[model samples]
Target: MVHTQEYESLLPTKNTKHSHRRRSFIIIILVTIAILLGTTLGLAYGFIYWKSRCIKTHKHVQLKHVLPGSFGIEFKLHTKNTSDTSTENDITIKWEHEPKDIRYRQKTEEMVSNDSVLTTVTIVNNNATVSYELGNETCWLNPDNSSIFEWYSILPLIMESVRSNHREDGCRERMWTTTYNGRRVFICIIDQRISYIRYDNRVAQSQEWMVPSQSSIKLPSDATKCGMMDSEMTSLLVVDDDKRQNTSDSTRQQLSYSQTYRKDNEYLKQPEIFVRSAKPDCLFIHGIGVKSPKTGYKSLKSMSYWGHIEKNTPQCSSHKFIQFNTVDNGWDSVSLHKMFCEFATGSNVDGRISNKIIFTHSMGNNIVAAALHRKVCSFDVQSSKWFSVSAPWRGSKVVLKLEDLCSGHLGPSHHKSENLLWLVLEHTKYCTHEGKMSPAYRTLHPTYKSPTGISYDDLVAVARLHVTGALCGTSPWGMGLSLSFSGTLKFIQSFSHLDQPNDGVVALNSCNVFGKKFQSIAKFALMSVNHLESSMKFGCRKPLCSWYQIL
Candidate 1:
């Protein structure tokens, strides 16, 4: 009985020892797993933080290294009157930035006007500062109305002038209203270029008017005066009543001539080499489908026809016309950039230096967008106006679909026997898939690389106009149909993925820049026009003529 008791006790101790060892092994495994998980999470977080720091540092370096050229100024007129009936025209503001010359001194008194209401001013002179004075407040303005300024329409022009003429020592200012000795007083002063603002007697009491940077202004419209008339010389001056009356009479004479020519049915004239204008220079860039004549290949003659029409128009007749030839096989943004940069730097065919206004169609729009984003063109020295028609700002689903079809060999087996069909399909694949590295696709893709280093706000420095075609009919028979059945089918198939109101070739939504949408100078939607007809139709010609007249 003593031996049996001892054996039972010894069995319990042995089993207990094994149990303790098993528990210790499990505890070690759990601790090891916890440490590994903690290490993985820490490494991931550290990598992300490092990447963010590099990006921030790169942006800081870019901004710090910006070369000074032209300076811009923003003027805000504040009234203490809290009344809701204040008119923006109640305060007359005038300013000028001019190089010291005889003509400038002579026009000084005429330029300083108290009768005009101007809220925003831009100083383009690299060497001179802008000067402004406010006129006596009128009864039409309520001192308490805080939103009486009409700065919305003219702010883009001011920002453009400043950006185009950026200078390190450029005078920048923000103005506001405050109470001085219980009376409403207006203040005009320069914004100090610093990290923070200190409100002293020199600044208005309201700190809200202080802008962080001169380039940070939010423009309400894209109608900029970058390459327009000289604001400093012409905008500030009020023309004499007699001179205005004479100008009105002359304008009527010109209108009468245009009306007579239209009534006589002599609108379409034979193509001729028209004399180039001395003032504004205009350049026309065709889309991807339009091959350059220089390539000695099948080219679209549509731009040439449009050129003839523009030359006949009264407004565009005097403006110089510049035609650019893009690559015939595939549209490339880098190639377009090189051509535009060369043209901007070189004198025109007429051997004259002038400002430019670019008109682009389809893929040409993407080319210009990429070039501007890359900052390849010297916009500060050669300002420009951009008009984009049927721009594929977003990548077209048609290209993606085509890529899949080519990759999958989904076409009819007989297509391999048809040489023409095979040739067309191969060319399409080459342009769309093989040319994926091209800047054109790079700009349109969702994962587009940002080359500008600057934000989309910087693009507002150039005036932009967008024109889209909508309300196209689903007509089965047209010139475009006879040329390529597969192409026509592709165009029809594109509508399935597109938003309503799309041109046969491009969707309206695809034409607009996503995320940072800049307000267009004008947006025109053409009704009852297909893709080909949009470029070839008669009604489409009229709006462009009108735009030229306004310019």
Candidate 2:
């Protein structure tokens, strides 16, 4: 009885027990508050670190982690690898990924392609020339755009996979087990520093966190000058991942010649901004009937031509323009091609020219097309792009309309529009080659000898020259005509001589479509614009859907 009473008293009184409970509850609340405060502080520190940290402490590359699990690759090629045999401008891209088609099973278990280096890229006259297995299939990139040859292109998927795995041991180990160009990669992180990016996957599979810095990283020396920002990188990730997930496997295989790279749906949602551009050294060639006080590429006089195209009209950041005057020579398209080859060959300040972007308006397209088809000009077809505006691929009937008006078929009584007099005067006076219409004007005729020396009736055969990036034609900004007065479209639309959809001077069929009718085409392909505005800048506003922007 005595032992039991002693033990019970020692246990506690009601007030004492209440006081002890209160103390315990206070301690628990304090501990929780401290933990939450610490967590908030840790997150803040992490955010700051992510915003400003280098891929290496030496700032070899800048990786700005803008979103959680979102990745970016900012190339900073400040150091020249004197130890390397390759030039500083050379960027050898080593890439590999999973097999495009699972059905195309590998002979070995590796599922790797036979080639390891996807491409060896070099800057030749400011254009990125890619030397790879698929040589001609590759397009030229502006050397200032470095997204393709960066490590972070493949990082988003790896980061997303790791982010999803809640049970990961915090080592943040990721392995691309499948082969890309005969190489499997292992990417791992230690002490929150990314390390161990090698084609061999053994170390990552083993989960050894102690990975030394990879010495094989090399980028083009001009990488630091690239224009694509972090938001663009995020957008690229979103678009690529979306296409990969949504498209059927068979469809994907059919769309691609070689699966250079691809991503799965596991990637986090990317931001809604993306851009790609090619602002190479541009050679602008003007169309027929270029009048006096001739606004060369320097004058910026004709918005109808590419005047102020790089800024006010078709905006791009870095493009070097060389304007060629249409009236500089009196030759036809065939003669112009030969003359152009000689001029282009000798015009090189550096004594060599390849991969120069050609910007043509009207008849210039045909002349350049002939030169390219005949291999007369030495433009690197594998890296060059041809952007033709107001291209009369099928030949316009409006030239006939002008010829009739000039020949007095439409008498002075019939022609009340003074624009008719202006056309006849300009075409005859400024653009005269013979007693009649100039050779440039004749080249615009549907039945004339084409620049290619082929019958213009076989328009498809003449229009079949291919470049790596061929940008063709532009839609007329629906407004007042460049040559004539108001209601000109209505006049041309009503004219017996002009029966088709005409852009005042060039018919729509001639400028863009060459008789192959489809129910749907890209919106950029659709013609005509602006019913309300009377602006005479009737050429295309911009090539918004160009491969430089949309692709």
Candidate 3:
């Protein structure tokens, strides 16, 4: 009995040891899991912080913020109006690199009845001093949200045109002038080379506006001028009450033609020999200012088309070209189409040649779109090629906004036309007429009807005058978004619906051709290139001399 009892005690001891071992195993597993969980949580938090920092940096880059040391150092000046004359001696600008000597200049001038003051800063390094004009109207504009501010800022070229000639005897175009924040201002942007009229009171001289460097910023192409004009200037007729009265007196003519045309009226073309060799066959249209040709040439070599309309031939030698002219900006597409079909589409004076490829630019593009939609041309759709460059198929947004403010004094069609005649008409109506643009439309229709028997290659060269200064106000994607989006969406909503290729400013998918997505094809593409680059490749820069000399 004693032996059996001892054996039982040993068995119990063994069981107790086994239980302790089991408990240790479970505890080890729990500790391992806890450590892993803590590590995972720490890693997740670190990743979140890293991602947030990256996003912040990207945002800054988009906003054009130069990273510290990117431009060597951050430099800026804070300007404030001062009335405490005694503080002038206390004013000290602690610049990182101080100017050798700094001097301030001020001028006061009267405008109509009010006096305006302009201030400038001059910095001298030894005897060489750089004079900087600060208070010029454009430079000193109150920097406000008013249209007067935005318009003058974006359309400097247009404003320059009005200022230089609008008040002269040759030019009597009415213009809108308004005072903003106690200062008078106008909206125009002409080339920097052109001279402008001085303000009635010469408080400040016009300063050379600063254009942004391409490495840091990209500006719109049309913000500056391009191309050249004819040496033998064509005259334009101006009719006004004063001229009318003078003409009725039987001593002076009712209207006299001036020997100059707006820079927009000019053209550049290739040599006659080069044109004829490319495609003895092409079609051409004439716009309002274009005169009727006496006869058609047998080939592009003998082509007598206005030099300006065919100036692009050097770059487009691979394809045949045609030209069409509209009667100024006022002629409707229907009328222009009819004239093209009857006068331009047929053979020359002897009527022996065949109709060829159709092409147009500016107002001519508008006519072509109208013509194809109306089935005015009866060519094979597959074989025919249609193209246009810098065509503002959709109207300008600025014009529509101005019309809204003027209470029906400008129409959608006024700014809607991108060509010279259209702009002139729109300006005259809003500046002189009394129409309005309501229900702002931006961008051309994304899904437009392709003209029967015509494959359209539409190209848009965006202008800075319309894009800058109002990012939030104007649509980001140029003109008509809804019209473009819905039209494009409708055209490309299904692959089963398309029949050809299409190209928008840079996005292939925006075009509606060949029943595919905007950019589904290898052969068909939509792309965007810098306007200056395009001008260089095509030799669009004027004076030909500038092409070689200026560079």
Query: C-alpha displacement of 358 in model 1, angstroms?
Result: 2.1
In the range 1-551, model 3's lDDT, one tens digit per residue, is: 99999999899899999999999999999999999999999999999999999877644441112111111111122211111100011111111112222221212121111222222221112111111121221111010111211112222222222222234332243322334323354322233221222222211223432322323221112221111112121111122223222112211110110012111112122111222233423454322223223232122332222233344443333333333332222223344555555544462222221324444433354455555444454434333334333233443223323333333322232221112222223322222234332111112333333333222333221111111100001111111111112112221111112111111121212221223311221212122211111212212222221211111
Residue-by-residue lDDT tens digits, candidate 2, 129-207: 2222121221111211222222323333333322212223434543322223234444444444444344322231222
lDDT tens digits by residue: candidate 1, 1-551: 99999999899899999999999999999999999999999999999999999877644442112312233322223321111111121111122223211100000111111222222222222111111222321101001111111132222222122111222222354322333222322333343221111122222122232213433332212221111012222111222323322223422443342233232112122112323354445565555543335422231223432334354334332333334444342333455565655555462122222355555666666655555555565443234345555565655554544343333232333221122222334332223334232223333443344454532333222224322211111211112211222223323333234454345445545654432232212222222223443333222223333333343
TM-score per candidate, chains pooled: 0.35, 0.39, 0.28
The global C-alpha lDDT for each of the candidates, from Candidate 1 onward, is 0.34, 0.36, 0.27
Q: Give the better candidate number (1 or 3) by TM-score.
A: 1
After TM-score superposition, the amount by which residue 7's alpha carbon in candidate 1 deviates from its true location, in angstroms, is 99
Note the clash tally of each candidate. Answer: 12, 3, 55
Model 3 CA lDDT for position 295: 31
RMSD of 3: 23.9
lDDT of 2: 0.36
